[model samples]
Target: MNEELRHQAYAQLEADADRIVRLIKVQMDNLTMPQCPVYEEVLDTQMYGLSKEVNFAVRLGLVDAEDGRELLEKLEVEVSKVHDLYMQEEKLESKEI
Candidate 1:
């Protein structure tokens, strides 16, 4: 792929990652429990879509497999952090009740 196309692919990947992170944050912030079924469904679908995008980039030679894996790992870490925060808040709320 040409440099421009490679750049575009990277940009799209970054956007996808940001979108997922934002949705997670919004759900966590607005919901009492972060484990809502609808939220889980949406998250799963978004994650699958992002994985497919990364796979396509790898297949097209726009990104390396290792790099794609790293990108996903970073997103996972962010999601985990948000989840932990949500759990902590839930614990605090329960204690207050």
Candidate 2:
């Protein structure tokens, strides 16, 4: 694989990951709670799309399999952190109410 192509693939994947994070953040801020069915559906769809992208890149020799897996793992951790924050806030609000 050409070095430039490899670099572009990796960059694009990272960018896609960032876009998903932003989307999740927007949903988290202005839409349904994390545990809502709609929220879960969106998250699942986005994650599945990203996983397919990663698999495609790996098959094309543009990205390593482990690297793609790690990317997904890191994104999951980030989403969890965001969800946890919202959960904690919900708890506090409930207590106040």
Candidate 3:
């Protein structure tokens, strides 16, 4: 692949990862609680979709395997942080009540 194509692929992957993180943040902020089954379902769907996208890119040789792994890892960490924050807020609400 040309250098520009490789760069674009990587950038697109990064943007998708960022979009997932933002979605998690928004979901936590305004939608169901983290413990809700709906929340779990949404999270699972989003993660699975992103993984499929990464796999497709890897198979196409648009992105390196290691980079794809890293992208997923980083997104996982970010989503974890969002979940943690919601959990913490729940705890604080319970304590206040």
Winner by lDDT: 2
Superposed model 2: Cα runs more than 4 Å off = none
Off by more than 4 A, model 3: none
For model 1, what is the alpha-carbon lDDT of residue 87? 90
Error of 1 at 53 (Å): 0.6
Error of 3 at 87 (Å): 0.9
- Tell how far residue 85 is off in model 3, in angstroms: 1.3
Ranking by TM-score: 2, 3, 1
Global CA lDDT computed for model 1: 0.87
lDDT by residue for model 2 (16-91), tens: 9989988998998899998799999999999999999999999999999999999999999988888999889889
| lDDT scores in order | 0.87, 0.94, 0.90
Which candidate number would show the highest TM-score if scored against the true structure?
Answer: 2
Clashing pairs for model 3 are none
Badly placed stretches (over 4 Å) of model 1 are: none
| lDDT for model 3 | 0.90
